[model samples]
Target: MAKLNINVRSFSYKKGIPTDPTGNGGGFVFDCRGILNPGRKEEFKTQTGRDEAVIKYLETETKIALFLEGVFQVIDISIEDYIQRGFENLEINFGCTGGQHRSVYSADTTAKYIENKFPEVQVTVQHVVQEEKNWINEAY
Candidate 1:
């Protein structure tokens, strides 16, 4: 089996509904937005580069790396063991209010992290609610 790194969370909330990782089996899903601050849901009106929200997401991931407690613990166990035993696939999910900004950034960040950490693993970023290219083109 090909080594699979699944990113389940949608790119934006509109399309990025997270499924039960347990149901999918033993793979780990690191929910940067869900576990760290589930209650602080807010809609970002304007996307700012290097904004507080983005910083928060990055901070959350870093924190998870340090302790490996809570939800992150599960991922740590799965990936570490899988790497040892020569496992084929792994899955990760990052969720946020809209999935567009925070979740997308988180997923991308995590994917890059893992790939660099483990060169053998294949990483894929699946955006749930992909923005329309036309809209972006029009805006630009």
Candidate 2:
């Protein structure tokens, strides 16, 4: 089974390719800046995407759902090919102006979706600026 490393980063903190321990230059980077930003609202200014309010706002008021649908379509293909090819590592990154909100939510959602869909694959999600990481299948 292949393992997927989904990284979420802040554009303000880092640019260019993410550090790949696999050393194979394998990954995809998606920019979330084009999506509606929840940070622009005063009520959500202090909130991260992990918060229920922010998640609800993003899900209801923005195009994030559609955007992620497209993201999953592309990533699903890549994941399948990687598993078939016996490749062990695949990385996908989501970046926004700050790693706190949109990027974090997207990364977490993507990781969970991958874990549910492909239980045979290992999945790890990391939020760069937040310093948070989750190993989805580790407890299973």
Candidate 3:
């Protein structure tokens, strides 16, 4: 079985965090609302975090890089520990006010990080709010 590194999700605080469909329980839930929101600006209102403009805004204008650095450190421990213990499945969630910008960026970035850093484990991302709208997920 493929051991899950994280169940990263971008969620709205109003809607609450998403449950793990991975069937295994317990993981990190990072709140991205504390980061500066680009959604407040009219230019970025319609853009999701995946967009280059919003990505640049988050990386340059906000503390998201620092926040994610700390996140990677903490998650690295769990990944290492899980491997040591012979475990499968871990959970991780990222939440913001709308789940469109900060949370989505964080979740996607973290998944990519794990895929590159670990290379053996599986990484999954769920954009809770965006998926409800226009995003269609593909095999990762």
Candidate 4:
């Protein structure tokens, strides 16, 4: 059993995501920013976003096979190197425009993917921009 962590801010940028495994390295951190739709009219602050058709296409059964293949390429290289190390953590970041809809959705999707693939590992989602602890505390 091992531990892998993925951090996704949104499907907009890859500021926090990590590059693919280069062997003898840590786990993976998928950049979900590619999945975000910039919106019809580019605004400084707003949630006009959507997933690109290309991304949806890649997630399909056929493409997912290839996608997973690439993901596993890193995983395999990492696992072989780190299995003896005991544990590994992958932090994936999904960033979108407003960090509400697309980012949240991508994070959930990535977490789900990790859970399905590595059932023994722990998967967690952290909605940094959208999750407002301040608001919750104020309301309480």
Task: State TM-scores per candidate.
Answer: 0.56, 0.84, 0.91, 0.48
Model 3 weakest lDDT span, ten residues long: 131-140
Model 4 per-residue lDDT tens digits across residues 1-140: 55544333343342343343324343444533344233322341243213344234335522334443465566545544444466555555555544544455556655666567666665566666545432121110
- Model 4: weakest 10-residue lDDT segment is 131-140
Clashes of each: 8, 0, 0, 16
Which candidate number would show the highest TM-score if scored against the true structure? 3
Model 4, residue 121: distance off in Å is 0.6
> Residue 31 of model 1: what lDDT?
45
Model 3 per-residue lDDT tens digits across residues 1-140 = 54645567888898987887767767889999889998888888888889899999999999999999999999999998887777788888999988888999999999999889988787778888889977543211
Model 4 residue 136 CA deviation (Å) reads 11
Candidate 3 residue runs with Cα over 4 Å from true position: 136-140
Cα RMSDs, all models? 6.0, 6.5, 4.5, 7.9
Error of 4 at 8 (Å): 4.8
Q: What is the Cα-based lDDT of residue 106 in candidate 1?
A: 58
The top-ranked prediction according to lDDT is 3
lDDT of 3 at 71: 97
Better of 2 and 4 by lDDT: 2
| Model 1: per-residue Cα lDDT over 1-140, one tens digit each | 44645443444344444564436564544444543432233433344212576456546644534422354445656777776776766667665554545555556656666677667776676755434431121111
User: Clashes in model 2: which pairs?
Assistant: none
Model 3 alpha-carbon miss at residue 105, Å = 0.5
Candidate lDDT (C-alpha), each: 0.51, 0.74, 0.85, 0.46
